[model samples]
Target: MDIRQLARGTVEWDRLERVFRTLAERYDRTVVRVEFLEADNWLSTPCVVDDEWFVKIVTRQNALVHALLTTGRNVGAITSGTGGFFDRFETPLGMVEHEYEATKRMREIGLNAPRPIEAFEVNGLGVLVLEYLPEFETLEELPDEVVRELAPELFEMLATLHEHGLAHGDLRAENILRCRGELYFIDATRVLEDRVAETTAYDLASAMAVLEPRIGARETVDAAAEYYGSSDLLSAREFLEFVRFRPDHEFDTTKLRSEIEKVADLDRG
Candidate 1:
């Protein structure tokens, strides 16, 4: 709808509530019963309904722009703010469709991600309902010892997602969870469709974005490599590069290609 207005600032709380109400009515769910998952937060807020489903509204413009910009460059289209940028994500509804499809695709390949429940669009916001998998704790919530033991397992989860031809675009530690004994990846919002080496590489590099701080970079990489097995491994130097130039909502990867050069260097040695 209003591209200029939306891009100008963050979505206001009152406005988001209003938008949520309008969309919730279409689902025949009462707004009063829903408790906002987190308040005083900046990004999308997911609400748990009867502890069975997690629902949220998202436009994911930044993520969509990254995809468009990446694909555009390959075809040599205008990078950002050009006709292509706005044209691609003109409908937040479409973005939701991508996320829904991504979620379903993950389940199709036997990956442990929340299953999509229902989806709809009202005005410009897209509404999504996902099956709730309760009793999960984020990677940040674990003790150092647990993180050390789970790092390899965490890496394998990502590896499995990749091996099945899917890339969890948002692999931040918070998006990763430990429930029971398994690692369940949340926020498959920015999954990759290209399914190429670069897409998978960018996904792993994004993994480094958070893993480095909590459990140390090289340690995590080595552990992940042990389980990842066939997929490429990141060295200390490559990891350093990932931190600097990892993918973002901005859709720039000039640094990612440069980092790919040193993957063969084996910085560990």
Candidate 2:
């Protein structure tokens, strides 16, 4: 099967069920209503899931789900859930299963993470069933002022994680969510606890990388200070200075100044 079909966001249930049978086989265990989170392709397909059970398929637009499908991989499809969402990857089931375990670990440490319902594999693909979180806005969606206000809270969350011997392997803007005045770190799929200090530094650096740009260096520093009552935490970025995914920390200011001076000299000439 072509991998790209998963991202097209237009797979009908009848066409999708041939390889893996969820509704046909586990009819009673799955949710009856299947909602489509997307609206790209709807061709008189009133309800492919509408059969003996009178089920409705619903779809919700999700960036992570889109990301998984864009790679054109379908390890498994979940035909039942909050809205019948599915995530499949060409990668091994082991990788996806790590996400489930990470979520549980975060939850154990008093951090908010969705619980994993079940996981299965089909056709050499990994399919995960995660608890559906209806509506939560990521830190990426919030305004700068709000981010500044919550900066200390963000730092505290990182501190809590480190204290529990864990690190948010994939700490980024989109993974941190705010719901009803409380912040919830949603995507702990990459959460793990090896090299506690390095991982802790990684989490702090990642959060600061995002916050420093939006709220400026001083306010970001203040946030960290508010958490630990010391500026030491602000320097956590040094531990991950060379991380490829992270932005440079003015590591070349002198070089940048030299180039600027050269351009100025040429313009004057």
Candidate 3:
């Protein structure tokens, strides 16, 4: 489907109005109304609301809102004229569709992720509303013990996806949520068509590189290997190799790689 049609097919404005009305009635509190919030050259327009929840309208040419609606995070949402790789590619609605499909496949495999509530098209926009998760922090901010306890399960989830020929385009710590002693994967955009081993390996390695500092290098690599049953899937050395290519602005990755190598060497010896 064309981009506009894809946007309109995802959410129904009437349905959104009904949903908002129901939420307002249930919450019994006036929704905090405000203009769009802009930061870092991005804008999240407040579209609809209730006291505890509201729909954020993001204005961009891409299907980022649709992806978030289907996959459960807003990582793909880009800012116009922000200047980067995103500026060159037309936001493909197919990506949004693929993410939704991936999330459905993941749920079938018993992976932990945010449950998608509903998807609909509203006023030339694709909107997805999901169960709001409260009181959670991204894995990036969690403690090492938490990462050790959590990383294995998440890795297993990734392994399961790989087995099914699926890969999360972005698998960083911030895309993972910790709630009530469990981790939930979010943001399934960039789901590609290829089932190549390198695709899956890169995903695992990238995730390991991003999380190593929080979880430690040895634990990160070991957990991934253990979960995938392949030491080659993401080794400490491979993680270091990949880190060097990452842009300097990726401070977390640069720092974690340094720290993880020190710990990994000690474990090896």
Candidate 4:
């Protein structure tokens, strides 16, 4: 279907406008205009509506929708893109369909994720409305205490995903959202099956790499061990081994080991 039709298809433009309006009113703000944010590596053009909310228009070839965000909350609708690689990739509408389905399935399995509001297809573009989370921060910038609290929960969720034979293709700090003492994962576009263990390991390793510098080695190892509930998942020795395995990435294990020993001592004390 065409862009106009898609915009007014499953979700009537009137209804979408109302939603945006309601949000504006509820937040006591006004959106006078929509501005273009960064477009490229995922078409994300945000409409600047006053200072309260930014209506992000994200589109792929066959799918497009506006993601509404307040200064504090991220919530909005999914829509189709009007141009770019949509045609070049010849990406079937099925990819979007699968993504929403996977997200729902993950939620059903008790995974921490954004709540899906609604999903439909218009003019070949798939769209989903999801809960907007506010006052969230990325895991990369979180404090050690916060990371300690989040680590086990995240690992538990990862373990569940592995147990259920699912994997989030792009598992990274940016994709994880933390709000009000809870963690919510976003961006399930690359969900896959049959490689859960490998995928989980890769994600864990990636998270460790990102967290190492910020958290230091010992606390990092302690957190991993605590999260995995087994020294085997990532013991201090194993962590050192893993670091050594990748000489290209320099890490200080001496400090890490000391920290782990200190944690152990604390536990005993």
Candidate whose TM-score is highest:
1
How many residue pairs clash in each candidate at the backbone level?
A: 0, 13, 6, 14
lDDT by residue for model 4 over 1-269, one digit each (tens)?
55444442343456446545655555566754433333122323233444334343334532333211110011110111111111111232454455567678789999877665544434433444455565668786688777766776776676676667776644566667787778877765442344344445545554555456766765566666665433333332333434333323455656655655666566557
Q: Could you say which candidate leads in lDDT?
A: 1
- Residue 187 shift from truth in candidate 1, angstroms: 1.7
lDDT of 2 by residue, 9-77 (tens): 344455445323664455454444444332222111113233322121222222335344323211211
RMSD of each: 6.8, 12.5, 9.1, 11.9
Tens digits of per-residue lDDT, candidate 1, 177-232, equal 78777777776654335534555665666665556556665565566557543236
Clashing pairs in 3: 10-120, 10-121, 11-120, 11-121, 11-122, 12-121
Question: All models: lDDT?
Answer: 0.58, 0.51, 0.52, 0.50
* TM-scores, all models, native as reference: 0.67, 0.60, 0.61, 0.55
List where candidate 2 sits over 4 angstroms from the true fold: 1-20, 23-91, 189-193, 228-235, 243-269
Candidate 1: give the clashing pairs: none
lDDT of 1: 0.58
RMSD of 3: 9.1
Q: Which ranges of candidate 3 are over 4 A from the true structure?
A: 1-58, 63-96, 229-231, 234-269
Which 10-residue window in model 4 sums to the lowest lDDT?
71-80
Question: Which digits, one per residue and each the tens of the lDDT, describe model 3 over residues 24-139?
Answer: 44557454442222211111233433223334332243455443443321221212111111111124334333445555777878777756544434344344444456676877
Candidate order by TM-score, decreasing, is 1, 3, 2, 4
User: Where is model 1 more than 4 Å wrong at Cα?
Assistant: 1-32, 39-43, 59-88, 229-231, 234-242, 245-269
